[model samples]
Structures are given as C-alpha cells and as structure tokens.
Target: MRVLEMLLVTSCVLVLMVSLFRNTINRKIGTIAGIACGSLLAAQLLFEGYRWQMIPVYIVAALLVALLLFRRSKITKPLRFMILALSIVLLGVSVALSVLLPVFHLPKPSGGFSVGTETFHFIDADREETFTEQKGDKRELVVQVWYPAAASGRSGEKNTVFPKDRGLFHTYMQAYSGYLGLPAPALDYWKYSRANSSIHTDLHPAINPYPMVLLSHGMGVGRILHTSQAEHLASHGYIVFAIDHTYSTVVTAFPDKRVTGFLTEQSQDRLFEDSRAILHVWNEDITFVVDQLEKLHSGAVASKFKGMLDMDNIGMMGHSFGGAAAFEAVYSNPRIKAGVNMDGTLFITENRDAMKKPFMFMKSEEFTNINEKQAKYRKTPATDAELKELRLTREQFDNILANRELELKLMDRLSQQGQGRTIYIEGTGHYNFTDLQLYSPLIGLTGMTRSINGTRGAEIVNRYLLEFFNQHLRGTESKLLAGPTEDYPEVKYPNSVYQGE
Candidate 1:
C-alpha cells in the first residue's frame, strides 16, 4: 500500500476503536479524536486520491465521526451498538479490499543501466489467424521492447512503466478472472500500477548492436506479465522484446483501438492437441517477430532499433506455453543462438531430440515432483482402487503418464548432448517463473501459487538467465552456469551435467 493508503486505514481503525467506547470517554476527548481521524481521512481523499473500493468505509467512518462530534449527548445505547457494528463491518470490508487488490510495487532492478521501453505493432502478412475463422486475416502481434536508455535524460522525467493503453489492463484482469473464476473487479486495481522502465527514450548510445532476448508469456497471460524480468534484462544492457501472441495472450491492444482477448473456447479437454496447435502458432509468432526485428535493423521499418539490434547473438525465453515455443524456435530457427524454458512442458512432441544450442530448463518444485511422480506411475501402474483414490479419470491419468514420459525423453536427450541444464527451485510453482508472483504475494498466500517470494524468485531466475545468455550470446563464461554455486542454495541441479563438476 502507498503511504497515504496505510495512514487512511490506520485512521479508520483508530476512529472505529474510539467510537466503540464513545459512551465511556469524555465528550471533549471523543470529539477531538473523532475530528482528528475524520480530518486525516478527508485530507487523504482530497489530496492523496480516492480509491473507490474503500470509499464506502471512508464515508461510514466520516459520518460516524461527524455524529460523535455533533450529537455525542443524543447518542442512545442501541444507536452506539449499531455504530460499532457498522464500523466493524466497514473496517473488515476495507481491509479485505486492501489486502486482495493491493497496489503492488515491482522490485527495482539491481543493475547499472536505467531501462526504457517502447511497443511496436507487427502484422504477419503471410499467416492467418487460425484461432479465428476470419479469412484473409493476418496474425498480429504487439511487441514491447525494453532497452538500456541514456542516463542523461533522467532529469525531471517521470518514469512511466506501463504502456499508454488503458484498456489493456482491464482486458488482462478480465481474462485472468475468467481463467481463475475470480471476480473481474477484484483485479481492477492493477490499472493504476506502473513499471520501472521509462517511455520510448533514447537508447544508450555507447552500446551498438546490443545483444537481444525475446520473451514469451505463458498461455492466457500478456507479455507485460513478465515486465520485471524484461526490465531486469534491459537494465543489464540486453534489449528485450516481450511478444503478445495475439489471440493466445490475455490481451493484445493494437494501435487501431482493436483489443484481442484470449481464445478461451479452444479445446481444453484435448490438452495436448490444443497445446501443440497453439505452440505451433506461437513458434511462428516468434520467428515472424524476429523477421520484423531484422526489418527494423535494416531501416525497412521506422524503429529506434535500426542498426541497434545484434541479430547474430539472439536468445529466446518463455514461460509455460511460451517456453515450449522458445524451445521450438531454438530448434527450428538458426537465428536463435540459445533458449530458456521456465517451467514450460514441451508440447511439440516431434522436437524431442537434443537441441544443438545451449538450453536451460528451469522447473518449479511442484512441476518437477509432479513429473517425477507421473513417470513413476507409468512404470508401476496403479490398481483400479488406487486410481479411484487418486480421483483421476483413466484418460487423465494416461495423459499425465504420457506427458511425463515425453518430458523425460526430451530432458534425457538434452542432458546427453551436454548442452542442457535442468534445475528447479525448492519453494516455487509454475506461476513463480512469471511476474505474477511479483504482482500479488496473495497468490502464494492463498495457496494459488507456491510460497517463494516473487522478488526473490525473479532475482534468481534473472541471475541464471543473464548468466546463460551472457555465456552463449556474448561468449562470456558465467561461473554461475558452469556449476551450482552456494549463492542460490534454493536452486537444485537434478540430473544436471553441470552438477558435481
């Protein structure tokens, strides 16, 4: 919460406590406390801004204080009880809103360079939006690029982290709510949040042809969901491009006021088939975006990236479905030097072979355990009674087993080639790999995600990502990647060739 928000809540509590004992306290003392608390809250609303969620509580408190100041002697016993009860109810509602829809702050990037960001709209003319039945339609992507900016432009400049599109946040929260079955308005507070990067500022002129990294968000998530990670890479001198895969992303707001929401009607029962279909499209999305980047570099497109993109040393990273796309891109596209899969299960069954380039598989503890358990279940098939106890349908159980087996085959191939690293964080879940952890610790608190702190998780992921990209893309040896270090004890290298070396 912001400073004034905290103060307002505290003042509400004080006012409520004073009102509870209004009959016992001296009239003058009660009046002064009521006036002080009410005045503080009024000041917060007048100057600090009003949050609609808490307005009802604020009004109730203000009204109670006003009554206590003006009609202290006229207050009957039953009326005093009603006031106390109402205050308690209002306080509870206020606190609940504050906790659930918190104004979360992203952790500052711990790097040398300040970050600047810009968004570009690209139309993949050759491809059609297969997710929809629209004929002759080109697949569109909104790519947000974050890069190191010149520090000299910082004076008196407000660092606006979020894009100018107001509808984007509403769309994101609405899609997220639909996916999770939560109230859409519960996440509306995110509309006010901002990122750490500045708006389309001049690129840091000292570095030419900056190493580039492409970021892909998980399914039903927008590219901005990984803003913290993107900013971190930008702060450390890597130009990062986070792509919003049109219909696949939670929301994609185009320049022409067109908003594309996630394709939720796709096949959920046929998970693998749906995933594969989506993964294929996303892989094309990545390659197409890279082609656009080439155009930007060649001055074919009006972009600041002209002559600034180091296409030779490009890397790809993604979360969940995006991660699968990253792996597929690395396997199929020669332009991509390396890749990182942040807990994304490989959906492209054909590309199970060892990736020729360096790749890292960062897994969440829950996913790692689930995969291992599923693999074991495949070997030792559970009896009918055991299966019933597990509450998994025969098809569901078989799918889990198959997915586990596929993951093993893929990881085994990568491990054998000596270019892959498989590591999992001790206290993390699939969502920890993305910026959702940073968005709300409530996710972890409510058992919606793992217990790992979002900032710490991002820091760990960023450290490994930086090291991996630096080593492969920049030819800089990262001791952190050579072997497990004591620096991040929570990271475990399971079946990793780099382990024990």
Candidate 2:
C-alpha cells in the first residue's frame, strides 16, 4: 500500500474509535473528518492502489477535527451533521471515480520516443527441448514475434485471441490490489487488454524477417511486460520475438486451455540454477526459431507468409533476469549479433577477457542510490489513525544483503571490461524499466508515494534506449548516444569513452 492511502485508512479508524468512546462535539467532528478522509483514501485505493505518503494529510485533518470538537462550540451538532453529510457524498463520488478511471481514459503520459513495432504469437513444440530437466513435457510456448515489416502493406495474419483467458488475465491483473490488502480494483480490468499483437499488422507482412531480436521477460512477469518496447522495435524493421520462458512467468494461458504458473523464484537452492536453465532453454528456443525463420524465408512454412522473412540478421535482448538470459544466449549462440541488457543483474560466469561483445546497459537510479537501500523498519496502517510499525527480522536483513551481493557481482564484470555502455535512469526504480510503473497511478496514493512521475521518466528512458539501439543495432550514427545529448542531461555515459571518429 502507498503511504497516503495507509494514512487515510488510519485516520478513518481513529475517527470511528474515538467517536464511539466520546460524546463531545470534537469527537463527532473527528468522526466526520475521518470519514471524509477515509472515503477519499478508499477511493484512491479502489482506484489507484495503496501509498504510504498520504497519511500526513489525514493526520492533520483528524487533528483539526479533534481540536474543533474540544475547543470550538461554533461546530455545533447541526454543523457536524452537515459535514457528515458532505463526507458521505464525497465517499460515494470517490468510489465512482475509482471504478471509472481504469476502463475510461487515464491520461496518456506524454513525450516518449517512437520506434518500429509489431507483435505476433507463434506456438512451437521445441520449447520443451530447451527444458532438458523437464523433457517430454508438452511444451507449448507463446512467442510474440516482433519484426520490421514493409512500410505500406499488411504484415502478417492476425492471431486469434483466446477468449477464455482474456477474462482470466484481466481478473488476475486487478487482483494484485487485493493481495496487497488494498481496496478492490474499481476499473474494468479488460480496458487495455487485447491480443498479443498491435494494430499495424494488417499491412505488415512476416516476410522481410529483417534482423531478428528475441526477448525474455523477468521472473513472474509475462511476455507482454515489454509490449511497448517490442512493438517499437518491430515497427522500425527488427524481427523481435519475446519468449515466455515456460515456468519463469507468473502464469501463462494459451488458446488450448492450458495454464501454468511459474515456480516461485524465492527458493534459494533453485533460484540461480533455474534461471540459468531457463537461459539454456531460451538459447535452443532462439536457435530453433532462427531455423524456422530461415525456412519461412525459403518459402518452407507454406502458409500465408511466403517470401517475407529476412532470416539472416539477428540479435537478442531481455530485461532483468531476461537481460541476463540475453547475455547467456549470445554467449552460447554466435548467430546473435548484438545484445541489450535492461538493468538485469548477471547470472552467467564468463572471463572478462574472453566475453567481448557489443552490449548496452539500462540501469535504474534506485540501485545506484546508497540511502535508498532496503530499510530496517516496516510499517502498516489498517483502517485509520492506527499505524503499526514492524521490526525487520535478521532473516530479512540477510536476504537483502544477499540480493545486494548478487546485483553487485552481476555488474562487476561489465564494469571491469570498461568497453560496453551503461545508463542509469535518474529517479527510476527496478520496476520502472518495465511497464509496471505505468500501473502505479491507477492504484491511488501509490503514484505519489513511490515518487514515480511516470510521464518524464519513461520518455527520457525511451529516448535513450531508441538512440542507443539506433546507433549500435541499426548502425545509425547517433551523437545522442555517442555522448550525452544537450536535451537529456539526466543520462550519463559512465564507463564509456567518447570517440571522434
């Protein structure tokens, strides 16, 4: 829950408790103000999600009501009744707003860069082969193919949506608030929901395969997590395939009515090892995909896509654990030309001298900040005015230490090489890299509590990524990436020297 939402709930609880105990006018005022604040907060929670920072406002309001009830006879029974009436109205309105915001227009954040885009799902049986440990399993993989298509023609046939899972995805998505103990999601969860592909596919053909790029999402995240990024690249002529690493994602439901949830990544014994296994599975997946692309380009798939694939040029990319998988794929497969690591901590072991390849790193500012490290104290507010502060046990602290070590070690090798480029987006957290940040504002005080402006941050990061990819993958000479551009002073080119050539 966000700080603000928590505070509001606390305030409401206090008002109710104090009102029941006291017969005074001040206590009544407190009850009214508390109810109003609670209504607003509940609206926020029902609409946006929970945040921690909103508590102060409710606290101040509660205090004011308490003072008025105790000291000001001006706030009579009638005046208190009027305030109570207003509070009730506000509560109703808040509920309505919370419910409408998700389905209706939640204003689009402005100022993001444009890039090529396309998304298509391709089912493959070989996904099972990548899983040696789980061999002979019915390995159905959902491959979201993103590629460069002709600027003026239909790209490929649109894949059919699985009507059954549409509702399920929507339900599970909104249910996140419930799990966090926040108010129920107020909006229609299916508003942004659609088939895996985007609109331009009607005119773009799967033919000109262009350069191939494979994407793997982080743990517990589905393939759609990087939807915007994948589409951007596809529109610009890169065949991008986002692989849903079976059992790595939280849940994957295919058209055939099969659903599988990822084994939790929290288990220590299997965390790193399982992630590595996923990478190898991805490597074989990519290689097989490349083979299929070759056949399709050679007119072998003999369906609607005949002569539209460019199978020769290929690359790989991933986010977080997926980013680490990108490195692992490139390390294992020579066919992968370039790679992009979106602030993922490394899992693969390789020599600093031997592992030389073109790579780019997009890291978050939270990881770089010293004071933002995991806190020792945890707080929770149920209802209002009642705040519970929990002490972090030794185990929690140790877990944090382990995570820090893992992150540091992952970046150490790239830091040593001093060849690749890395950009730490200022004021961004780990979740900021993916589309998860976009969901913050929908959950109320969370947007403010998390300090995520959403608009400027994503724009800056998108520009940086586009500029970097345009320079390296497409061989476009971009001064924006060669060094810091004048417009974006927030981006720093650490560990990379500028060249005059």
Query: Against the true structure, whose TM-score is highest?
Result: 1
Per-residue lDDT for 195-297 in model 1, tens only? 7887778788864699999999888777877888999898988999999988877667887878888774445368788777777888898989899999999
Cα lDDT tens digits, model 2, 1-501, are 334544564565465455433456455566566557546655765765432233344444444455544554444566556555555455445444433342222222222312223333455664444433675765556666644444454544432222234566555555433433554343233343333343344325442335557788876676765665665565555556777776667666665656666654444445556556666666666676666667666787653335655444566777787888777776677776667777676655545325566677777775455323332122221222222232334554444445555445445555567546677766666666665555545532543213555545556655666665566566787777677776877666555221111
At residue 452, give the lDDT of candidate 1: 80
Candidate 1 overall lDDT versus native: 0.79
CA lDDT scores, all candidates in order: 0.79, 0.55
TM-score of each: 0.88, 0.64
RMSD of 2: 12.0
RMSD for all candidates, in order, please. 3.7, 12.0
Give Cα distance to truth, residue 221, candidate 1, Å: 1.7
Q: Which ten residues in a row have the lowest lDDT in candidate 1?
A: 155-164
Instruction: Name the runs in model 1 displaced over 4 angstroms.
Output: 13-36, 46-48, 52-60, 72-93, 154-168, 264-270, 349-352, 383-400, 445-447, 496-501
